[model samples]
Target: MAERYGVVPTRRQRLPLVLGVLVSLVLLAWLLWAAWSHSTPAVAGGLTSYDVVSSHQVRVVVDVSRQDGDPVTCTVSAQAEDHVVVGEDDVTFPAGPARTVQTTMTLRTEREATSVAVTDCRAGSGGPGARAPGR
Candidate 1:
């Protein structure tokens, strides 16, 4: 032999490297899937304003963003000064051809409320994709 360039890796020595590569590939695939699944939500909304109409009524204005034509249901709740839930209602609407919609809901409460909000929103008339609360 003239001059050996470099020693070839033996099968035994390369086994761990191959196994590590396989394990890393598997982990990377799993991470990609997890990230993709949670990248976007179906429904989201927020309370724009609220008005205390009377001792037993509240008017709430909200802005909702969602996929077009996806029927979404949201829960609006009225709370008293001590953060007690004094009224609640389920409001459902379709985004139609728009991605955002502004709505107003009037709730009759059992007592006076200091604040009103959209607590949760979900996609589809068939239930929901996922619940995003406190939006």
Candidate 2:
């Protein structure tokens, strides 16, 4: 009788090994997804900024907050007719989930105000509060 040089894997042994590897991969992927989803925070509540144009004065309303923390110091800027009308303000708040800051400034230009723009609005770290980072 010829002796087998190497041992061959039986069908039962091969199936269990293949199935075990596939199941482990699937479980690892699910765990990674769950961790990522929980770390990120969603923009809860109504946080928005708008420029209100009127006859005498132009008003800028800035609303910003974190998901679970005190109100962040948001820097606000306003412009009229391509000129820097409002500079910037570092507004802080007490310990809470979120906060809103509203600032208003009067324009002293003789020319009729055509348009108003608000930019450089930021929170948490400090950035130009201009329409967020990547839209």
Candidate 3:
């Protein structure tokens, strides 16, 4: 191998290095901004509590936070002991002058469910996954 210990990089070599560094910085900044925006999303939801009311029903309380004017829909599900969905449905929070909402609803199940939870929540029934809704 040739010794490169005393060799100075030419302008051509330094140009590519500088360009690569600039491109890397820009890409990193964009990535950070994207992550920060997504972390705070447009809406978020969580399940505060649930009740196995009967052999065919489960009552769940969902708490959601979002922009005051945009209506959001959340999917809630009841699962059997085997982790199979016994009941699932979409709950739409109507647009109003509130950023946070706590809703309680009962899901009629095919059989007794071992657990109930809010699966996914979004601004509209469109995107495959917006970010969050339910924890």
Candidate 4:
């Protein structure tokens, strides 16, 4: 018989190679899903309105929602006309009957605040204290 001219994969070798490719594809898919999921925010909410009660105080209202009914934490901030952060506070919401709740927070500022908003929000598992942006 003529000798084989090319490298032909044997059955044993082919089995391992096919399995390796399948495993690699599965791992790649998992990694892609994890990256996509983490890149998006899990919490949903926004600032409803803000009122400057006084030169040193601001009342901010936010509507927060989590489908899982889990508690959430929010950062309320007040900014002066110059776009400087005058006041900031971390407010925690305990688990309640409603998944969506409107929260009112009061922030004390060093000077008058021209605008206020809810800057960031996350799940309650973030623990106590404030969350700096990008955390």
Candidate 5:
């Protein structure tokens, strides 16, 4: 191996290093701004009410919000005592206003659901429908 002491890199070598750092900085800045601008309150509130309709079913109510009148889709999940997912459903929110909305969703479980909650909510153009297992 050849060893050199107190060697300084030439301008040609340093140019690519400096340019790479500058490019990385610009990319990071753009990502930050894009995230900040597109970010919106996904879940406005938690489960408003949860009713155990039966041993294999649950009725859950949640409050969701968005920035426009576009419809929103939410994933409602039910968990058992062991925190295992027993059931899940995707319910759509109709377009109305850019404000908080109270949505009721029904989930059918294979066993029993000890707790239910809205996992995710997002705004988009879609119609109201139910996506549940064995439906």
Candidate 6:
């Protein structure tokens, strides 16, 4: 009988195919690790206390005690009555297992404020504050 149009792959061909798949997997894993490392926070901390020091400025202090390398970049924002008042700011410091960072926010209005929300606070990972995954 005549041979089939497409023959099965021999052992030599299968060996190369397996090796190629393994190499691809290793490369993919490495890429994933690099991305994760880059995104992780270089410093660990959280907002501890915030107070209005004056009519036009407010003082904010954060406590960071979990990180081990590099100073954390802090970003602070303030909002009054659901409207954003102060924009973001960046603060850097030396690497510390535990440390406090303080920043002052200048307000646009001196009138008594009802409520304020401060957000976009983050360290490391680049930028003033840590951004969401898609942001």
Residues 66-92 of candidate 6 have per-residue lDDT tens digits of 345555555555555556464444445
User: For model 2, how does the per-residue alpha-carbon lDDT over 1-135 read when each residue is reduced to its tens digit?
Assistant: 135566677898799999999999999999999999766643222224444455434444445445556434444444456573534333333345544433333333334344444333333543343232212
Q: Please, what is the whole-model Cα lDDT of each candidate in the order they appear?
A: 0.79, 0.46, 0.81, 0.80, 0.75, 0.54
Model 2: colliding residue pairs: 120-128, 120-129, 120-130, 121-129
Candidate 5 or 3, higher TM-score: 3
Order the candidates by lDDT, highest first: 3, 4, 1, 5, 6, 2
- Tens-digit lDDT track for model 3 on 1-135? 237566677998799899999999999999999999988879998888999999898888988898756878888889999999999877777677799988888778999999888888788643443223232
Q: Which candidate is the best by lDDT?
A: 3
TM-scores for all predictions: 0.72, 0.35, 0.81, 0.69, 0.68, 0.49
Candidate 3 C-alpha error for residue 127, in Å: 11
* Candidate 4: pairs in clash: none
When 1 and 5 are scored with lDDT, the better candidate is 1
Q: Going through the candidates in order, what is the number of backbone clashes in each?
A: 0, 4, 1, 0, 0, 0
Query: lDDT tens digits, residues 66-111, model 4?
Result: 7676778887888999999999887776666687878677778999
Deviation from truth (RMSD, Å), model 1 = 5.6
Q: Candidate 6, TM-score vs. the true structure?
A: 0.49
- As a whole number from 0 to 100, the lDDT of residue 117 in candidate 4 is 76
Give candidate 3's error at residue 30 in angstroms. Answer: 1.8
The predicted structure with the larger TM-score, 5 or 6, is 5
